[model samples]
Target: MSAVAPVRRRRPGRARRHRQRHGYLFIALPMLLFAVFTVLPIAMAFVLSFTDYSVIGETNWTALGNYTRIFHDPYFTTALVNTVVYTLMYVPLGIAVALGAAMLLNRRVRAVKIYRTMFYIPVISSTVATATIWYWLLNPQYGLLNVFLGWFGIDGPAWLHDSTWAMPAIVMMAVWAGFGTNMMIYLAGLKAVPRELYEAARLDGANAWQAFRHVTLPQLRRTTFFVSTLLIISAFQVFDQAYVLTKGGPGNSTITLVYYIYNKGFGKLEMGYASAISFVLAAIILVFAIVNARAVDRENR
Candidate 1:
């Protein structure tokens, strides 16, 4: 009988080390960029929050003065209140419209791809373009929105100009511009749902609403959680729309927190106060994110 030769395994030697070195080299650029752009700015902002940092002037340490001032600043209070109100309006409406659109898109129809593309067009459009178009559409006197409302004999409020209606109008515009993305997300989640579940639901004599509530919603809990989280974060960081459309309004009624931060930072050049407020905003967002994640996790369990 011939002697059998045993196979030898490859050792972790120079070749493996060479590959590892190459991999590290590939990642080094991205890591360096992240450190410079993201980490460095975050660190600077945190430190600046405790100092009176003016862009082109002498600085003095303020310790917690900026933070303390936040509590007493009526502008901050108003901005905070407006932000909360915007959140309340934006979150629910955004979810509802997105889900409703998603459900509609989930159907098997001819030209469905075209419909999907049309829905997603707004997402790809520039924020500036969207604001400009909406600015024209919201012209209370000659705008198409009011013109349409006139057909029903409803007196449309001066949308962006009216303090009472300005925020809601902006919310309406944002929802239209943004919901397509969540709809696409929901559509994906809907696709992943097992067909057997829906078939089983129907066999049990469940109607459409019943099936949606029991089968659909349960399967989509994770998706809903994700969508709601994005909406909340976006709602908190809302600036561009208010900036372009209302400019925080006739009475500061639409003055959102981020807008206030922008005004302080660059408008009034109160960099330290802005930095402090921004940190507080970050903290608030963190708390909300934690609560959202925990609530969903508990329910999933």
Candidate 2:
């Protein structure tokens, strides 16, 4: 009986513990870089928002002045309205087009890769270059768009030159430049969908449209959620296209929140005000992301 002592199992060795620590060490550099480039700047901007920093004088803390002014500023209000309208128009249309393209390309057809490459060209292309090209394309007198409109006996609006049509023009340009990425994303989503589900749907007498509605849509729900959320954020933060095309004109009709921030920071030297506006933009984007997440989760359930 005295010889029946139990042997205890030891914990993980020093080597295993060291490996875990080393794995975390590899991530440390990237985390530090992100903090430096992203986190620090956001914090600095938020602090600067409540101040009266200008090129003419030293930065002085002015509690709630910039934010209160934002509420009262007619130009900011106009930009806010324009941004919301642009997001509403762009997000739905972008998703529809991307999903359509993805479905078309998801088939077991020839030359699909080539089509994907062609579609994605605009997404990879530089925004400045694309904007410049579209600037001429939307030109009133001699642009290609108007030339096409002539076939239908429709006169094209002055895209960048007129206040009335400028925001619409921006939306169109953004959709063209941005939709390719989402299309590619959707293609990947479609590929991940199981073939058995489609076969089952077909055997159940579901047509192509019906199959897509019941099977494809459910499978791609996550992708749509991601794509829509990203597109909403990007659409809201739209700046370069408007800047390059209209320079926030004809009479500031195309002046979005980001463009306004740029003007405040660079043009007016109102860095504090610009920072406040930036934080507002961040809040809007966060809310949109949360709403999209909840919608997607509900669909999954």
Candidate 3:
């Protein structure tokens, strides 16, 4: 034993160790808060999804009963379908509108700052107020929308009241309220695009439209993907507009997954079912997010 000596691993210097500690200290509060607020709630919800914990009622373990019941739930099916439709409508339109706004704003025109402020105002305004405004504007009989439609001799249908048109009405309002944020994101992306690309395109006799299609679109691919993912996520979680404008009314046409979850958890006190639906929605969102990411990545390849 006296002839053998163990070699210890070297340790980091005091300054290096102190810097690492400081770095961890900087992140500790955020990680702690995330665990407490986000991770804990998700874990609690996952557990509750397997049990019949109806808030005030006796808690009972049902295994996969809630999840199994989801397949048979008509409301869930309708809500899921409605959510998909909303996402489909919103994601493309939102991207287009945001991109268009970004392009227009990128122009070095006079008073462009004021135009930006006006566009961004809705993004910061109260959702309730925005919904209220849209509600007024969408009035079939007394609304500005109908008035404008009537100018073209095209009678706008009862927007929020008509089941067929309700979801679309919601989509329009959401796009209007949200495109501002996406516009700013796209504006940043546009700014980052190399001016040399535009110059090369111009040198090659590319017009504005051609330049946009070839240079701008290709350059903003990543930004578009980011915006699409955000739009997809937000579209699936759409609750405020539907709840405010229609309350999932007009025969549940506007009933989103989140709205359905709220109705179950609060309205019917079916916390277990709500949690199960929430998890299902989370899964669906994950799938869509993955698909979009892969789709964009594939294009890159």
Top lDDT model: 3
Model 1 lDDT on a 0 to 1 scale: 0.94
lDDT of 1 by residue, 1-301 (tens): 9989898997899989999999999999999999999999999999999999989889999999999999999999999999989999999999999999999989889998899999999888988999999988999899999999999999988999888899999999899999999999999999999999999999999999999999999999999999999999999999989998989987999999999999999999999999999999999988888999999999999
Please list the C-alpha lDDT of all candidates, in the order they appear: 0.94, 0.90, 0.96
Give the backbone clash total of model 3: 0
Winner by TM-score between candidate 2 and candidate 1: 1
Evaluated at residue 3, the lDDT of candidate 2 is: 96
Query: Model 3: per-residue lDDT, tens digit, 7-86?
Result: 88999999999999999999999999999999999999999999999989699999999999999999899999999999
Model 2's number of clashes is 0
Q: What's the true lDDT of residue 286 in model 3?
A: 96
lDDT (Cα, 0-100) at 107 in candidate 3 = 88
lDDT accuracy of residue 43 in candidate 2? 89
How far residue 146's Cα lies from its native spot in candidate 3, in Å, is 0.5
Error of 3 at 106 (Å): 0.6
By lDDT, rank the candidates, best first.
3, 1, 2
Q: Which residue window of length 10 is worst by lDDT in model 3?
A: 1-10
Q: Model 2 residue 289 lDDT? A: 89
